[model samples]
Target chain A: MNRVFTWQQVAPDQWRNKISELIDSGFFYFDFLTGVDRENIDGQADCEVVAHLAKPDLSDSRIIFTQVKSELASIADLAPASSWYERECAEMYGITFTGGDTSPLLRHEGLGRPPLRKSAVLAARVLTPWPGGAEPEIREDGRKVGNVSRRRQRPPGVPENWLSP
Target chain B: MKHSFIALIEDKCTSCMLCVRECPAWCINLDSHTVEVTEEGARRPKKVNVLDSFDIDYSLCMYCGVCIDVCPFDALAWDEHRALTSTNREDMILSIADLRPSGSS
Candidate 1:
């Protein structure tokens, strides 16, 4: 399959103008917009706002991305389809969008941290005991025997100190 | 055709935990213990994993079939039989015995 990949990184201040310029040039079709958490990546933006715009016939497409510390100007006014996407980015990545409806998208109440952020800890994994920690033993008269010499195993993605006493 | 449900073949399962870790929903829970098998005239006793308990919470499962795909032992398979529905939420969790094919033991 022949495919062309085009992407550009723009400053947060020029994000709204870039989308408008792209639409006027020929890419008016709005594909989708979302936020990427770049906390783990070295020397990158805290969060990256990415949007895909394509021509009406789907011949050419461009990925417009902008790096932001925590806030980005809303492009929903220029592209109506991006309103919900902006709201989703607001709730998921904790990105504040100005000049648009940044209402709650998936969350009902205020949570501690953005769920998609790398720093957000998975509380459920820590609170519940992992079943993989079970150790085998011999049974005598329905009673377990022998001491467990193997160390307990932690589930993947869970931190070591989270399970420590 | 009826909706397929996950069936566990007890003897084939070594409880390696591949399915539990691969499950994206985090619905599968398993417990296993190690049994020391000492043979006659053997240098050292070999440790074998014994399957203690395996539970799948259907409430959280998305029926993605990821667990069956990642089972290295071929212990898990899809059965054509319809899955049971329960009124209580807690009853949705199927244990090792409940996951076995019907009419087998």
Candidate 2:
């Protein structure tokens, strides 16, 4: 069986230090992330971050999880150690890494509702004018593409947009 | 070389030492009514307390999939469902969670 260390839960603000410790332990692999419902009470945002760490050989799999309550929410970005793939995490999940920009990854023209966040409070979290301009030139693997389409044209390099409105 | 691993099923296993007997590494350990893998790194199966440890010496496993094929209760499995990093012998010792859908690399 695996072991679970339930010490004082790490607050969102403390995630920076916590991540540093994990990275130092040669546990660079940022395992998993999800919103864990830790509230058995009337109401509490006791969410948790469940992470699994493995030794370099992927052995010594250690499953250590931490809890975060609503009183102290929003983890800041961990940079340097939390770069590259880390950025992707922030943009996708609202895991505010200490140094990461609290920006939306897919703001969808920066106008419509953010499909990722389900909170009613964020009805208008999307910044106006969105990120891209009207009918911005979309790029595909370096080349510009028209728009999203369903039909597909045969052959190696045919752009799928060729069949769209 | 194909990696070979040893899986333990406590209920049907009874720690009979059959798998351990067959293993040449002497890496399997029976303790706490469970099989513990002392192996440093390799695709180790994820088991509970009934199973102490599952050590797969990646350096030695030949990927024979014998452990999976030989388990009496079909508890042992060779997870080729996902191809992982082919480098580093340590990468072979799959984490305890890696044995599941969420634990995957």
Candidate 3:
């Protein structure tokens, strides 16, 4: 059976130092770094940063997760392998990393809001025309074949405000 | 001489809406309506959805075959044939009636 590990919180101030210490202690492999948006929760940061580190033999792995209220200190400078992950998280979540490259990885400048942000709503329907042409129904000898009354459900990830139409 | 084409089994299709969701090119347009289905030797009838129309716009289709792969029921099949060609854009939109077997019509 595969075992799951819990995320350990790292203070924003000492995050870099703690990662470095883990690296020095043989946790050399940097697996991934990502962020989650938490909008419903109050008194907590809107984003959470999660990073995974492991040994070369894959015997042991550790996860470090921190609730970032604001800008987070960079560990890419210490790990080197985490540069792209940091860049992606920064681009998608709009979380800045101190002493690291804040350049966008997946998006160009001035495109829009960081898509992964909790408050970021998708593009309105008016901006993007519905690709599927007019819905079709079968008519047999001037009578409908089967009549389904309800409208189709909206696509996932569409905000509630966009459901009016 | 040989030819192949996509064979659509209209009766087997459950109208699960899987092909509509999986079609990346947005070439497929489908609709369904609910109707009563009475099983043989059964006392009561069950309400089920009957597919209204399954249309595919060949003008926009890239022939990626994603829709056929995602179908839960084996309603769509792949058949080899000459390339689809038409003189007008409107002719490229294939309706459910056009998809029926050659002799059945």
Provide the TM-score for each candidate, comma-separated.
0.78, 0.30, 0.60
Worst 10 residues of 3 chain A by lDDT: A126-135
In model 2, where do residues sit more than 4 Å from their true spots?
A1-9, A32-46, A69-81, A84-93, A101-103, A109-165, B1-105
lDDT of each: 0.83, 0.43, 0.74
Ranking by lDDT: 1, 3, 2
The two-chain DockQ for each candidate, comma-separated, is 0.39, 0.01, 0.21
Deviation (Å) of A8 in candidate 3: 4.3
lDDT of 1 by residue, B7-64 (tens): 7888898878778877767788887666778999999998777788889888887888
10 residues in a row with least lDDT, candidate 3 chain B = B1-10
Best by lDDT: 1
Candidate 3 CAPRI classification by DockQ:
incorrect
lDDT by residue for model 2 over A90-122, one digit each (tens)? 443344444444455544444542233333223
lDDT of 3 at A113: 79
Displacement of residue A128 (Cα, Å) in model 2 is 29
Identify the runs in model 1 with alpha carbons over 4 angstroms from their true place: A1-14, A56-60, A98-110, A138-141, A146-151, A156-158, B1-3, B101-105
Per candidate, native contacts kept equal 0.39, 0.00, 0.18
Which stretches in model 3 have alpha-carbon errors above 4 Å?
A1-14, A38-43, A56-59, A104-108, A117-140, A143-147, A160-165, B1-9, B16-27, B32-49, B55-105
The collision pairs in model 1 are A135-B33, A136-B33, A136-B34
lDDT: the better of candidates 2 and 3: 3
